[model samples]
Target: MKYSIIISFLLLTVCLTAFGQEKQSRKSKNPNSAAAEKGLIKVSVMYPFAEGKTFNMEYYETKHMPMVAGFLGSNLVKYTIEKGLASGIPNQPLPYMAVGTFYVKSLDEYQAAIAPNRDAIRADFANYTNVAPVILVSEVVR
Candidate 1:
């Protein structure tokens, strides 16, 4: 009876120790360290346009990215609009594209800026020649 009691006690201790260690690890990973340097959030919006489009490389490089950058607040850590030829599938040719990136201080700020005027935001790209675009949102979790 005494041996059985000791075994049960040991099992309880092992379980408690495992739980404690897991909790500590999670807290360390996502610490609310006000003094520690905060991380930036990066959102990449990918655009896919129709074929046979007339896209002025100069306008997108000089004008489009800059226009989006203006709407972002001062907290923007980085902003970029890039263009490249899409890598196509087998026996397929991909079209030219423009990609917009909004890198900010946090996810909440991103939601606040785009949620109210989503349609307007979509309309902003109406001028692109024979093209449709896709937007992808992601958090910079590191």
Candidate 2:
């Protein structure tokens, strides 16, 4: 666990340094790039890893996400699903079991669509994952 923590910190630091430099350089070249992305928002639903948590990737990928996309329709620009493999160290448990994200054109539109079907969405959660989802809503920077 200690080794995993150390590796996580090292990997995070390296990634942040490289990512910051790249974004800074690109922003300098195109000052309006960030401004253009201001209207877009990202909604991430993350399922944290736990010893007994269960995730049905097959259902999440083939059914759950598709239903979400269908609900959002034109409001959603794109959506993606990710499966966790490692936690920065070899043989270490993953930090998250799965993550799903939506890049939406309009937050208000997305909310409007989601509000009506929220119950159905929540109800379906049990069909794919037993772990509760952590939600994050953020404006796109670039």
lDDT of each: 0.65, 0.90
Off by over 4 Å in 2: 1-38, 89-92
Cα lDDT, model 1, residue 73: 69
Cα deviation of 100, candidate 1, in Å = 1.6
Query: Model 1: per-residue lDDT, tens digit, 1-142?
Result: 8987787678667867987998788778877632232466777766665656655657655766666666676757778777766443222455446677877887787677767757765676655544665666675555
Q: Across residues 20-74, which tens digit of lDDT does each residue of candidate 2 receive?
A: 9998998899998677667688999999999989999999999999999999998
lDDT of 2 at 16: 79
Clashing pairs in 1: none
Question: What lDDT score is found at residue 122 in candidate 2?
Answer: 98
TM-score of each: 0.57, 0.74
In model 1, the Cα lDDT at residue 64 comes to 63
